[model samples]
Target: MPGETVEASAGSVATRDARTGGGTAWLLGSELLTLFRRRRTWAMLGALALIPILIAVAIIIAGPAPTGRGPAFLSEITNNGLFVGVTAILVAIPLFLPLTIGVVAGDTIAGEASHGTLRYLLIAPAGRIRLLLVKYAGAAAFCVAGTLTVVVVGTLVGWLLFPIGPVTLLSGATVSVGDALVRLLAIAAFVTVSLLGMSAIGLFLSTLTTVPVGAMAATAILAVVSQILDALPQLEWLHPWLFTHYWLGFADLLREPMVWDNFIDNAVLQAGYLVVFGALAIGRFLTKDVLS
Candidate 1:
């Protein structure tokens, strides 16, 4: 009987440890579920999904967009439904998408701290390193999910309203419809990867202050400021380092032979930002006092 009781205790410890292990897989699941339950999360996703609808409606009404100075994809969308999805993603990624990411990333930790919950969360066996990783993962997940929302919704809207066929690339070459679909998916993925740097920046800012609002605003400002700097003629030397610099490299995915140079550079640039800002967040998070 004593042996049986000891076995039960050991099993219980194992189960608890599974949840509290270095992997912290259980905590990650719970946090993600919690994140999805927030109304703001749904609101952000809904806003993203709405972008394509608005674009589709506007173009459907405006006719062929002058075919010259307007949006590059405008002339193609009515003919190829897939471009609707691509254009929506292209439009949203610049501002609305990053702003939404900033709001969520900034709130992840700071929200808890401001609400007097960070201390309690840390009081548990969860390591700061583990918690920080989970928070940032949640933020990145939002980025991917948000980007996907625009793509899926836009594609559906386009398929319903416009003719469905092969997408015409900026180059004169034409590919099969199936190939175009794949390229659109790749473009969506590229857009998501491009935002990793922004996600890292947002997550780092989130760690700076207990005020979630401040963190959110500061993160958005950083993105906007980086983009502004990227546009300066005299600051061409700094373009390579800016988070927004290579964002439009998705345009390459549409080209025949699939241009890899700019695309690879963008990925490497984002990786650098991810490493630097991610390290900054982890370092600061580990040492900072959690008075809230």
Candidate 2:
């Protein structure tokens, strides 16, 4: 009788484990689809696309840059329109770009909680960690999508409006049109990687509040504060630690002899931010009360 009771209890525990332990991939897929379907996602992408178009048109109408005022890329846009696209991305990455990521990432958890869907999601067998991963994946998808919008639109608009061909590197070496395009792709990837830190920070903030607006505004404000601190001469000691300090380092990618030092630092720094904040979000979410 004792042996039979122990066996029966073990079997019930096994059954419960089986029900909750699998299907992680399916849950991730469903969350990705839901993120992609949101109207706000599409609208944010559309707005981002307009930046490159406006840059190309303005450069075309204004004639060649005087070479003394605007960015080095702008000065060369009249020579090869490719510069227009790259230039647009450079402009966006510092502020407008991260703001978009903040909007999406900040809303990841808080939005659902605000609308009372988070409790229902937690009621499933997917558990807290799995749900958080799905949320992070959705935010990461938005980062890639937002960067690609600028890249694709910038390239096409530049091609249609100006000469498209071989490009002269910042180091004075010439690269084939094909090579230049590849470099542009690398630049876009770099920009996307740079935002992962912001995404992580935003998601962490989202876990702190049920109000999506508060999360979104707080995330953007933190980014702004970091940038401002990075600018202060007195805070030079803290530059290396600031998330935005190396954001513009993608410029090194365009050099004839591609420099990897700053680029690598940027990636490593972002990865660090992601790990720290992602852990914080998970730890807090695990203990957080979810009555909504």
After superposition, candidate 2 runs with Cα above 4 Å error:
1-22
- Tell me the tens digit of each residue's lDDT in model 1 across 28-146: 76667667766678989999999999989988888656666555686788788788888788789779998898898888778777766677667677778888888888888998899
Q: TM-score, each model? A: 0.90, 0.90
How does each model score on lDDT?
Answer: 0.81, 0.82
lDDT of 2 at 47: 86
- Number of colliding residue pairs in each model: 0, 0
Question: Which digits, one per residue and each the tens of the lDDT, describe model 2 over residues 163-258?
Answer: 988999988899998999988898888888888899999999999999989999988888889999999999999999999888788878899788
Q: Residue 39 error for model 2, in Å? A: 1.5
- Cα miss at 61, model 1 (Å)? 2.7
